[model samples]
Target: AAAPAAPARASGEEIKSPMVGTIYLQANPTSPAFVKVGDMVEVGQTMFIVEAMKTMNPIPATRAGKIVEILVEDAQPVEFGEPLAIIE
Candidate 1:
């Protein structure tokens, strides 16, 4: 079966994955997520971690704005250039 499409956003800048890997929304299992829907974020803020080739790489926000949506689930596999979040 085909996966459902992500909800269309009226206005927001998307944060895209830098590399193909598994995405972690939190620093650790018990830690709060780096950012969530409705949260305000600054440019360069760490938003997610993409583990590639056994290395953990922190993914930073490219623009400052309120996070409108998180497109990926915690620990989900992601592809390079995939949209991870929406900021407006």
Candidate 2:
């Protein structure tokens, strides 16, 4: 018998967070956020930037959809696999 395949992911939705660090909504306190709730996002588009150990990293969207929610606030600390935002 053949081995079973992995289950498929849900359709039309994605939540991407691939690291553990401080998630920032804006590049700086005075700047606007990369994205906001209800904004339409495309694959590879930056959702937000995270700061860890003085280094900044941009988190990109994995799928194209409208942002349903923002899970973190400005300067909020986040962990691995944390839900940064929900898109659908």
Candidate 3:
């Protein structure tokens, strides 16, 4: 009998915050979140937003992948290079 194949693993890349700011999971409180764990995303897709210096900046995905982890909470403060999510 042939041996069973190994299960596919998530080679998720850790997406970090680009600046010091508050992380926004959705466009607004009433809006659905931009993404969540297990959601598939394309390159350049808006993953989240950050508010810094009174500006809202949308964060895009660097590559096409599925989200496997969310490391930050909605409206939570984040610093540059802080791991925000894991994309596979």
- TM-scores across all candidates? 0.89, 0.80, 0.86
lDDT of 1: 0.94
> What TM-score number comes out for model 1?
0.89
Query: What is the C-alpha RMSD, rounded to one decimal, of candidate 2?
Result: 5.6
Clashing pairs in 2: none
Writing each residue's lDDT as its tens digit, candidate 3 over 1-88 gives 9989755544679888999999999999999999999899998999999999999999999889889988899999999999898898
The residue pairs in collision within model 1 are: none
Model 2 C-alpha lDDT versus the unseen true structure: 0.81
Q: Between 1 and 2, whose TM-score is larger?
A: 1
lDDT of 2 by residue, 1-88 (tens): 9889756533345565688889888878898899998899889998888888888999999988998877788888888888788888
Output the better candidate (1/2) by lDDT: 1
lDDT by residue for model 1 (1-88), tens = 9999866664788899999999999999999999989999999999999999999999999999999989999999999999999999
lDDT of each: 0.94, 0.81, 0.91
Candidate 1: Cα lDDT at 20: 100
- Alpha carbon deviation, residue 15, candidate 2 (Å): 2.2
